[model samples]
Target: MKISPLRSVRVTRYVTPLREGGSLPAIVEADDGFLYVQKFRGAGQGPKALIAELIGGELARFLGLRIPEIVFSDLDPALSRLEPDEEIQDLLRASGGLNLGVHYLSGSSTFDPVVNDVDALTASRVVWLDCLITNVDRTARNTNLLIWNRELWLIDHGASLYFHHSWENWEEQSVRPFAQVKDHVLLPYASRLEEVDAEYRALLTPEVFRELADLVPDEWLDDPASQRDVYAKFLTSRLAHSSVFVNAALYARNALV
Candidate 1:
């Protein structure tokens, strides 16, 4: 939970852009010989993106996916500081990193969707996980899925877990009910749903949740009353509907029989 200060990091001469989203993501090699650096473009939406990165990455790991190492980075904003909007700067400063480092993934790119698409089985599980976390990022258009080195890798969690009360709900909305997720992409992986739920429930301990909450900057949690109110609502909603999600996912996995 406690991340040490990064004294230094190595970068390879070779670095390339990975996507065309609001954030200009790239893959680069680190001094540690690690490939891929998912840098934050200060110009991108701002605090929300950073929170998305944290929540999505954490949940992905909790779901037992093979995610890469993620760390908070400090970058010189001038290199790619966020937009010049005053409101945006406040969000950028609140977020520890708006420039500097990049996210690391293993491969170059996935060439074929049919052959390279993440297996339906895995995708199904991913979908269910997304649903439980109330993520809205994974769409047919921006799957944010990459197939590198002949394996499926998920990136750009910045859009998921939107239901998280990490920041003011600029969109101010309630989480969608779990029972309503039958149409989710992970519907196909429903067969493994219950198991996934058990795994998820196990991971949402108070300590872990608090640690995650801590990682989020205080500025983001400025509206203490709204934040607490929203957190309670979101958490309660998740637990209340968790059974449906669990049962449906398990039934898909045949755990119900």
Candidate 2:
């Protein structure tokens, strides 16, 4: 369905602080009256986290995965005046501008692979996406996979593309074997990784890579088009040799079995 990027929505109210997180993300209601798990720019990770969320989530949706809709949410500084908590107050004030939000799943539960097994295709597609993006967060302890109405939805991709954290010479790092794949929650179940790799290689052409990388806001990159070009180059390079990671996954699964 070609889900696009950066649909802007103003945050109307902050329902509560998800204090569990160090960065102080929250459940907020937007002007559209839909609840979102918004990531604030004031947090330590700042826009980099939102940048990952947007690019990663959008790519997943494009590849036929059920990811929550992400939006550019505007936060009004005055709205934080109502909250008495000092820490949250500081965070709200710091995040008075545009923050990122992932549409909340109202009645969802964390995916427990042991209780509910994932089918081979879905598992393979997810593993493929995670490896391509270099997302290291989707491990057994923090699967970051959710199930709503018995359907799986991916969330919390703020950790993908960790190479961008230090872009000193990113090109050299992009195609490095995604060392963390061994811990991926879906790796063992993704027995069809090679089959999905062939299918996705055709879909994730250079045009698609540019389309997704361009979605990153210019402010996030010193040279928007140049960085986009880099992003495309890095991703296409990985996709070109995707079998390296697929082969690694096959070896991992074989060892486990």
Candidate 3:
């Protein structure tokens, strides 16, 4: 299946800083008259976080998971001048180019694992996706999930695909089992991992990875050593060794329960 490119928009207004995470993402209004949770390119993690957000979110969507619509939002350096906060001013100046935005879910609340009960299928899928991407932020502490319109939605994938932080050993990292699965928020409920694994594996192909990689903006992959193809190659290699992480999750879940 061919994936469509993300929508592009210009930031019309900066609403407020989220302040929850170190990156200082904010809610901003785009030219399209919609609010988006904008992930700035100039944040502490730099563009790699946005790249991870794009690839991880799109990959989950491709696997039939619910993800907020991701968009390419252009930030104007002039917008920073209007802000009184020197910190935000610096952020806007640094993120003057293309940034990432997630369609805001107006009244969504963070997922509270204790207060909410997820079905086996949804839990399995979430766990499986996290494993496939080596996402480490979905622990009990910070689920990075939301309940919007009475449905579970995944967001904030910047912490996934962390191997890119140090590309020197990306090949080995691709196939490594994610031991972090033991701390996963949904691990206890992911009883259907074996079943979901078989299904999701068939959905993720090399072509699919390439298509997702293509969605990433050329500007985000500006690192001299990291090209767009590298993203595709990393995921494709990881998928080939899916069983390694799949088994790791299964083991963690068993130990947990």
Candidate 4:
């Protein structure tokens, strides 16, 4: 699939801080007159987290999953001056540049595993996508899912693609099974893994991976072109050996059932 470049918007107002996670993402108003959940480049996880969020979220979207629109948000240093909190002020100052934002979903509630019921097909697709990306989040404790307009929406994928955190032995990491699948919130409902696996594997081609890699911004990477190549290589290699993780998720689901 040919993906268009992300829309760029400048942050016009420094809204309230979302203190849910350690990274301190905020609901900021953009120049386009839209509120966004802005993930900062200056956060503890740094630019790498934004990169993972972009790649993982877009990949989910490409695979027919619901993800809030991701965009390139420009932060201005002057926007921090009105903030009383020293820490937030520091964060705003540090994040002055290109950051990541997700279009804020108004009135959306967090997906509670105990309260929500997901269909086997949806569950299976989510499980498969998480396994493919080696996402460490999405456990029962924090699903990172939202129920907006009564539809499940995936979010906060900064915890995915962790192999990039330490590039050593990244090739080996690519083919490994995701043991965390056992703790996945959707595993119990994912009865159609085999079916979803077949469909997703076919949908995500080498070209798709390349396109996803190309979507990442150059400023985020040390070696823009080469690192993009590395990301594509890692993802394509993981896709090539998807069965390793697929079987792992199947075993986990079977155990849950």
The candidate that wins on lDDT is: 4
How would you order the candidates by lDDT, starting with the best?
4, 3, 2, 1
Residue pairs of candidate 4 with colliding backbone atoms? none
lDDT of each: 0.53, 0.85, 0.91, 0.92
1-257, model 4: which lDDT tens digit per residue?
Answer: 67657999999998899998999999999999999999999999899999899999999998889999999999998888999999999999999999999999999999998898899999999999999888889988998999999999999999999988888898999999999999999999999988988898888888888898998888899989988988899999998998899899888877878
RMSD of each: 6.3, 1.5, 1.2, 0.8
TM-score of 3: 0.97
Q: Which portions of model 3 miss their true places by more than 4 Å?
A: 223-226
> Which portions of model 1 show Cα errors greater than 4 Å?
1-19, 27-35, 39-41, 78-102, 106-108, 111-113, 117-121, 164-175, 178-186, 219-237, 244-257
lDDT of 2: 0.85
Tens digits of per-residue lDDT for model 2, 1-257: 34375689999998987775577789999999899998998887888887788888999999999998898888998987999998888888988877889899999999987887799999999999999899989988989999998998999999998877877677677666787888998887898888899889877787787888888877666788877788788888888878877787787778876
lDDT of 3: 0.91
By TM-score, is 1 or 4 better?
A: 4
- Per-residue error for 98 in candidate 2, Å, reads 1.7
Give the worst 10-residue stretch by lDDT in candidate 1.
Answer: 1-10
Position 28, candidate 2: lDDT: 96
| Residue 159, model 4, lDDT | 94
Best by TM-score: 4
Off by over 4 Å in 4: none
Error of 2 at 149 (Å): 0.9
lDDT of 1 by residue, 119-145 (tens): 555765686666666666655545566
> Can you give the lDDT of residue 209 in candidate 2?
79
lDDT of 3 at 146: 97
